[model samples]
Target: MDRNLGMDFVRATEAAALSSGRWVGKGDRHAVDQAACEAMRRTLGDIDMKGVVVIGEGERDEAPMLYIGEELGTGNGYAVQIAVDPVEGTNLVATGQPGAISVVAAAIEGEGKLLRAPDIYMDKLVVGPAAKGAVDITLPPRMNLKVIAKSLGKEVQDLTVGMLDRPRHEQLIREIRQAGARIRLVSDGDLSLALEALDPQGEIDVLMGIGGAPEGVLSAAAALCMGGEIQARLVFRNEQERERAKQLLGTEDVDRVLTMEDLAWGNVVFAATGITGGNLLGGVRYTGWGAITHSVVMRSRSGTIRWLETHHHFHHDPRY
Candidate 1:
């Protein structure tokens, strides 16, 4: 992949964020997602790449669906696998909550790198570089927190874990609290939570619990680029999903733990532009010029993470 491809990818995210930012706090969830996906798909079609979207994990009932095998880009440049959550937190955007984002991740297509996971639940444990390889997902939550705390040279009480506010995390939350670490539970957008967990100066020290499998793959790409670690395993809701997983993943056992490489490998490019104010980046702020957007772009091969603040001029660009 070209080194400058990350910049092109960020443009798509910015477009999504800019379009969707208008719908924030509008109480229209579907419209929020539809606007973002349309803008993103349009922007991606102009990029110089032959890209296939590997994962479209947004909840179909809540937001507009982007087909899993949809072909993107101009189809004339790098062959890549694309994964997107054009609006990671539709409800947040609708309700005027925080942490809504537009995310895009890509890797070389047909390279057997980025995992095309079945749309199911995935249990994940993610941490930053300091605690990389020091925590294990299979271990007890308290035990893992202890190890992570030790690695970061902090007490357990000083560490903060991020998770989705779901019933399935009840036991996990108990264990984390028992271990003396604090918790920050959000309504949605696990990808943003995972990214903040990887940030050295970010408030989230770890991210633990179950989230959508497609989001897990998206998070895995950011992990590869940001020197973070994620350990995950597929969680089947029923026997039918298990059979479908067998068909989709072939003989690869879903019961096995998936390292970051197994989820998303190669020189993956990950980009996210924030739509609402949150932990990872600031929300899109409109101005007389057009809008000001904040985005982060990263690449695994170069280990370069760029935080870009773009001022879109409506008169000059007219894409808005």
Candidate 2:
């Protein structure tokens, strides 16, 4: 894939963020998601690549666009596998809460590049580059926090773990609190929190919990780009998901610890733009001149991470 493809993906995410930004406080998650997906899909038509949707919004039956198996992008260029989350935190955006983002991650199309997982929950444990080899998701959260704290030269009490605030994580939260580590809970967007774990000198030290398997793949791509680490295992909620995993993995054994590479490997590019203000990237802000959007673009092949603040003049930018 061309090294410049990362910037093109950023433009797509930026378009999604801008389109969805207008619907904030509309109290309509479907509207938020649809606006983002349509904007991203339209913007992608201008990119110079032929992409197959290995992971995306949902299955063809569930979403109108950017769904699984949907072909993406345009122009005479490279073939790639794309996984996108146009509105990562749909509830946040619809409710006018903070920390919503539009994300896109792609790998060179091949068997070993991106895992083709169903829309199931995935248990994830992510850490920064410094503690990549230190923590293990199979171990207890307390123990992993200890190893992470040691790797960072800090005490367990000084470390902060971030995760989604869900009923399933009640015990996980209790255990982390028992270990004397701080916890920051969010309503949505664990993918952003996973990247926050890699933010240099960022507030969050680690991200742990179950989230969308596809989102895990996207986060893993960014983690690989920035030298961070994310490990995941699919968590089947029912027999249907279990059967789906079997069909995808070619076996009945659905439980296996997946490394970062197993999630998203080989020359990968990741791009995200915040729709609402958050830690990783600032939300879209309207100015008298135009609108300013904050975005992060990364490519694993070149080991590059670029944070961009783009100014879009609605008059000139037809997409807006």
Candidate 3:
């Protein structure tokens, strides 16, 4: 892991904190994402790497921020590619919900591949390496639950599934309820759900849902570094989305079995800064003195995971 390279991602997360939830999202999600995107783009420029947006917000016509394939940095030395989720949970921040974070990951030259994903739907299922091949989205939800339950030496009712709280998942919710398995519904943020799947000893046993295609790929990257498994199938219900996907993916088989290596490819670093409250990590805390922040930084090179909780105390004067 490049120690200095990690700082670029650190700056990106810090800039994401300056968004709508902090200043942009409450009433201006677009502006908030834009600000965060610009902040991320500029911060990346400060580094000594030539980078491009492999996974990011939306398309150029659909939205602003960091669109897919959008090149970043100042075209300098040391070619590097990035997959970033500037604001992983924009709606959560805008509506004052939970599980909002600023996340970014990168890899060295020739070790990364651009994730050309259009704004389409993708069915995702993920779990740690231990639970690999235990959960299959193609099968019925109940059958999948039972498979995971047996693998973990737990009852079906004891398994917890994390999913996006969207109307499209009504059938999945019903199935989970009927199957008697526990369900953890989240408003926004697929990366966290993916990470939950990567943590076997954690709360979530499986992550299954329909969300952004780029996010699915990014989650696959994290899962790859953590020795996890994920399966994704792109869903294009309209002509525009299909055309956009073809243009991006250059293939018709979006329903491909993609491993973790396929997602991130080579060595990477994953780091995130919380923006709101949640179960996995606490939200940013503030007080009369200054503010405090919590972060989880991981480097695939050394398999080191660091949980940093910092407090900053400020005085009226520049120096005491």
Candidate 4:
């Protein structure tokens, strides 16, 4: 469906400003997330839209804002399904790191399904189309890396991979080191990390790590639109979380690898407005006198991704 793509930037910027800061460590992630939610809610109020939360902060009653099944938009246009991460890297923002962003994607409602992601960790691997079927998450990380290396006609050491900069990634990191492969460790945010994996020419060959299941789902949605292969499996740490997941998914099978089509099915449109400077999208630019927002509006139906950097000027209200 054709909707107002340009105005989506207004909402994106609002989400970004609410939670801009160094919010790393055990600091209140809720505040940053809340900022994005509030902005999203308010921004939705201004548009004639009907959308469902496919991927959100949490389920109903669990997360006060942006819960699954929560209705958004002004309720006047075609219904759409929205998956949002107001601040993809709360820790990065809190710690003043690069690549922090307020990310969101939307698809036609009913055609899209929100993933009842398990609270437990999910192992994720992504590669471009050329390397499709070359890597498998079922194998050990080293073996998978080797396959990817062979597919790209490069040594494992020449392949640059993206990883999270956390102690939990110690073994994964060590294995890569032992293999003589280089690793690009990110302090926070995996949304861009996942995107990086899709662009081999961009220097990031693959993305292998354990991250939030919801994020894994969102990345799958984006990759679905971008033509990449991603495999994910739930890795629960406790029975309670597993049971909760099973109950939500309405199935006992937690070990499933979701493809791009599985993440975002049918027709969808993705709108992203940059709140901070980074690759894939540019940061919000201020001209001192006013502000100009840069954005990329995409439609899956047409496979057209347009780069738009628009300027919005604000001056004092004119009162007669």
Q: After superposition, how far is residue 232 of candidate 1 from its true place, in Å?
A: 0.4
Best of the candidates, lDDT: 1
Candidate with the larger lDDT of 2 and 3: 2
| Candidate 1 residue spans exceeding 4 A from truth | 58-62, 110-112, 318-320
lDDT of 4 by residue, 1-320 (tens): 56454336335544454334323333566765666567666675555678767677765324345777778767887777777776777655555456766666776666655464654577888887668877778888789888888888989889888878878899989888888889998877777788778755557888888887778877776566566678877878788778887887788776676666555666666555555566665655567675655555555566666666665555631000
RMSD per model, one decimal: 1.6, 1.7, 3.3, 4.0
Q: Write the per-residue lDDT of candidate 2 for residues 54-150, one digit (tens) a residue.
A: 8876673254558788887774688888888898898899999999999988888663387787888999998999998887889999899999998
Per-prediction TM-score, please? Answer: 0.96, 0.96, 0.88, 0.85
Give a tens-digit lDDT track for model 3, residues 70-188. 77666776677778887787777767777887788777776555355666688888877677877776889899888888888889999899998899999999998999999998878
lDDT of prediction 3 = 0.72
> What overall lDDT goes with each candidate model?
0.88, 0.87, 0.72, 0.67
Ranking by TM-score: 1, 2, 3, 4
Q: Candidate 4: list runs displaced more than 4 Å.
A: 3-32, 59-65, 316-320
Supply candidate 3's per-residue lDDT for 55: 72
Which ten residues in a row are the worst by lDDT in model 2? 56-65
Evaluation by TM-score, superior candidate among 1 and 3: 1
- When 3 and 4 are scored with TM-score, the better candidate is 3
- Model 4 reaches what TM-score against the true structure? 0.85
